[model samples]
Target: MTTDSLILPIALPLLGALLATALPRIAPLLGVLTAALTAMSGLWLTGLVWVSGDLSIVLGGWGLPLGIGLSADGLSAALLAMSSLVGLGISVYALGYFSGSERGLHFWPLWLLLWTALNGVFLAADLFNLYVMLELLGLSAAALGALTGSRDAVSANLRYLLVGLLGSITYLLGVALIYTAYGTLDIGLLSERVEPSALVSTSLVLMTAGLALKAALFPLHFWLPPAHANAPAPVSAALSALVVKAAFYLILRLWTDLFATITDAGAAFILGALGAGAILWGSWRALRAERLKLLAAYSTVAQIGYLFLFFPLLQALPPGPARDDLFAACVLMAVTHGFAKAGFFLAAGLVQKKAGHDRIDELGGAAQSMPATTFSIALAGSALIGLPPSGSFIAKWVLMQSALETGQWWWLIVIALGTLLAAAYIFRVLSRAFGQEPTPQCFITDARAEIPALLLALASVALLGLAAGPIWSLLGFEGVQI
Candidate 1:
């Protein structure tokens, strides 16, 4: 049953993609149904993990060295759940977003394929399998990013494709080196068999660099803003919310599990330093961005910085409740940003659709004309800003607590500065709503499009924030020192 649950999320979306490609007329409905089923399967698996334990399955009963494996630990399960839920919302929004257009047919299939790759990445237990999934994800995402048919969209995604291929090639080479040394690609087997050596360090650097490029961490993020900002709204949401995190997830998986014995404070601190640069640089750029989507895109760079900041703290703390809290907090922050960014991009899409442009200064009328959309922005912004009662607020709290506890108070200053910048930029958009403009005649301009944004934002604030206790439990941590 556990294996069935794990496979269903990936399989269903692949099936849906084929179905959508074969039956274009019913693509929208098919996408919604497929995404909903996938979400249900992921949620069920998460529940099973929470109630039971982590699951591992080898394909075709060929266990271990000869077979491909899929495993869902608490970490993978949480991410898989986030991907499915966000995907379902995006699918619904795209139905109205594409609305009887020829592009809708293309959108459904690519989006479903992307969803499949996302699930596959989270569940993949071997390095080689993860590489395959990441390539599929990159191709599908790049294709979807170019769906707008604008020259900017096409050019940006073309660059994105080339960069993704480069990153994948580097990552595959690292995998090859490791496999040659260890005679295996299974993450579990490698973790047990591997030892610290020059070969291992080289492989780590190569792999981490490749994954970091994909995660859009700091200087490597050059291709992200344009690719994300110019994509269709639903595509933008998925790209920002789900796609980049997949790479980061693999990085975290390797750093914490497979390479733990070989990793050290110095290496973790170096990554954290890059994260600090990302926070400062990305936030400054976001504040200066004239366009709404670009601001959101830059903000993704900053939020990703926060995820990397966890490493130093994790390294400084010894294994215990404190360490567990920091680890779980990282997952919490990633998932919170997932929901919040998805909502922000979806709401930004609506504003762009109605106003015909997304210039932040010119958005007064569009922001005011749709109260629900405005509210969605506000809610998501609060999460981004780490305002109270949002999941990000809780995550940030835990992060700061860990930092202070470890005597690394320097990170507190970084978090504080990022928080202030987040508030300023977020409210910069909300201030547009206060300007003189005719109010919305109805609370919803389009329920199909607006509701998903509202729901995702609300989840980030209320559902995730108030109920985060379950997250620790879901992650299989027993201590609650935080």
Candidate 2:
């Protein structure tokens, strides 16, 4: 509501992380409280943006290129709202997942710190601050992923940490190039100042490459599955649903906003080609995956590919209602995945805990025993497969329409193939629930664990799918014809 409130979403979690680190005994309590407050703050900021257009403020009243700034527009606000809702669900699920365990001592502080970085990334106004927030995000995410202390967890997260650092260094080098050429780091200023040149082209490639590694785009995605699958359940949810999204957000921002003038159809086609590879390869790998969480992780890689497929379409289309609708659809897909994936991971975690293992081939008893969790998986899987009544279904419909309208029908084949593969893998997992194992009497055994997953899944299926028009309004689009 107020300009000062922009800082609360970032500040509250940061302070909570400090307190949680200092007070290990009650860290979970502090963590949950902070999560609630941060979610509320994020929602409030989003509401203000929806009511009033964009909002920005210079911290410390120093103004412009010298002082720190925070801004929220439609794109940032939509992501913030998604992060808030998904993050709150993950936090509540963590409460039950880590109950009375030593893991909670470390999980709370690191998780809160990760939340702080996630918020900071979404709301960051400048490139340098984005890099700083990204560094913190990487460190915190790597730590949280290794909280299980398993050999595999530790090793995977170490690779994650190193890869993340490599990404940071590459991105920082690009930032330095931009600053040297333009004399400013503020995104708003740089957007206006950036011009087509070798230096700018090189910087964009460096930054995009680095972010691609973090986002796990196909060939660069070797590090994601192991890292995501090895983390604790709640940590896995955060990593799959939120952490990688932060990197992709930056890529989207730079491509569509900052470097639009220099970006051409060739560059967009290259990215789209890589995205096609990711879709086929990632989905094929998911179909063959043996573990439940590993499948979810690989599915994430495929889901990310869908976002990139929009680039060529975006580049090909002129700025008009068609382009605006395509852009909004891209955002809608990302937000839908955020909630759907989080719910899927949370429910998968519950099933793993109940089954004592997460092997997809051996989950019959666990799936049958927890009807609510099984149902959660079903709902989330529908979204992943782009089935009707899920947000992804609508987004894909628009996407295919645009592909046909633009005369680039090749993407339609990729989308259809990916959807089929997704359905195959999702149904493969769902099939395990209907075996010889007897069903439980009640639908939900644990309210604390099951409700969050159920609600998040339901939102993806019902809330976002049926009511996605607001996303167009939020993004300042006139409205999609479809």
Candidate 3:
């Protein structure tokens, strides 16, 4: 593939958003077609990255400091592929969920806009471009989250919008500081020029702090649960599964890639501590949540905490196979959660629609009435709990192994506690699936809606679980054993 192919993933959805906005009468058809094409382009780019090493392009034939650059390595390509797959699933689910509604008209454009931002983030090669993409992402996300128009949805998303703006402004301040200290906004240039100085340290701290808030890490995660729980189903899926993950991806990039020289074990430890707190606190809240969607939202907070746990371990290990394994495990955990959580939210939305409410206590007969959705939930919940033959299981196993190898055995206890809590919350919902109601005659009530959930959930278990070796290859560690 040529370097120009890099722009297709970002451009297709952008053009689709504009077309969708102009032609609302055919918005759904345009949205789905655009989503399919974007997914194809993303996968094609990922394939090129896998075959070659990395790809970079400066738009409009301009060089650094004057041109906008887009680059794709294993990290960005993996995320691009994840976003494409999960995004397509969400688009398909939205088709049946929003049938014959005016909200569908508005949803297509905003959703495509969000997709554009997501792809831009993964491909951006400059810090200023990242800020611009992040701003667009936050605006589209907040708007999509409030699409239901209920009082709660509006109130929660308003807070989300404000918090998101705060994060972007703080991040921009760091970008400005870096540009002042150095001479360029390109990450490649900045990385080469950055040195261990007060200005650089301050810039890293400000950027990490801002990104942690956006990623909903521990104490800064106060705004997440309500916003996710109150949004429409597809919106909720994208918010919890893809949106927050984007912020965390930026944090990982900064910590491991751009700012790797200056970052030390002490800073990594602090992040790991916050992650431990989030794991315990978020899981506990999820177990006690009364609403099903609220439970899933809290679970997302906890799952994000698990990703942070790897930072300390990664910092402790030197560059070798051990560190590579741990890093790959972290990515595997992230990709697994992307699929599992999206599937869980989609299935939960179906249950809510059928039951007319999402209360965990009153979902007995409503859950049993739809066998396919219930099964989807069961599969996804197993993955969430890190059950055997699931992607989370492999990731956590590698995590614990690295913890032991690095003499950070205390983290094993935190992982154990988090796993137990995850199981409790997931099982609590599954228990409600078994009721005295009569069995359904068929497995699937709606193929358009149910199949996407099932396929996504199965991917979490079967695709990522058994075929996890590909992840190591995708990350450019071909011979490493999982």
Which stretches of model 2 miss by more than 4 angstroms?
437-482
Model 2 TM-score is 0.90
What local lDDT score does residue 372 receive in model 1, on the 0 to 100 scale?
A: 94
Minimum summed lDDT over a 10-residue window in model 1 is located at 434-443
Worst 10-residue lDDT window for candidate 3 reads: 434-443
- Candidate 3: stretches off by over 4 Å: 437-482
For residues 153-203, write the lDDT of model 1, one tens digit per residue. 999999999999999999998998899899999998999998999899889
Ranking by lDDT: 3, 2, 1
What lDDT is obtained when candidate 3 is compared to the true structure? 0.92
Per-residue lDDT tens digits of candidate 2, residues 1-482?
38788899899999999999999999999999999999999999999999988989899989788999999999999999999999999999999999999999999999999999999999999999999999999999999999999999999999999999999899999999999899999999999999999999999999999999999998899999999999999999999999999999999999999999999999998888889899988899999998999999999999999999989999999999999999999999999999999999999999889888888877775555898999999999999999999999989998998888888889988987898799989988888765655334365899999999999997896578656889999999886665
For candidate 1, what is the lDDT? 0.92
Give all TM-scores, in the order shown.
0.90, 0.90, 0.90
- Residues 35-76 of candidate 3: C-alpha lDDT, one tens digit per residue: 999999999999999998799999998878899999999999
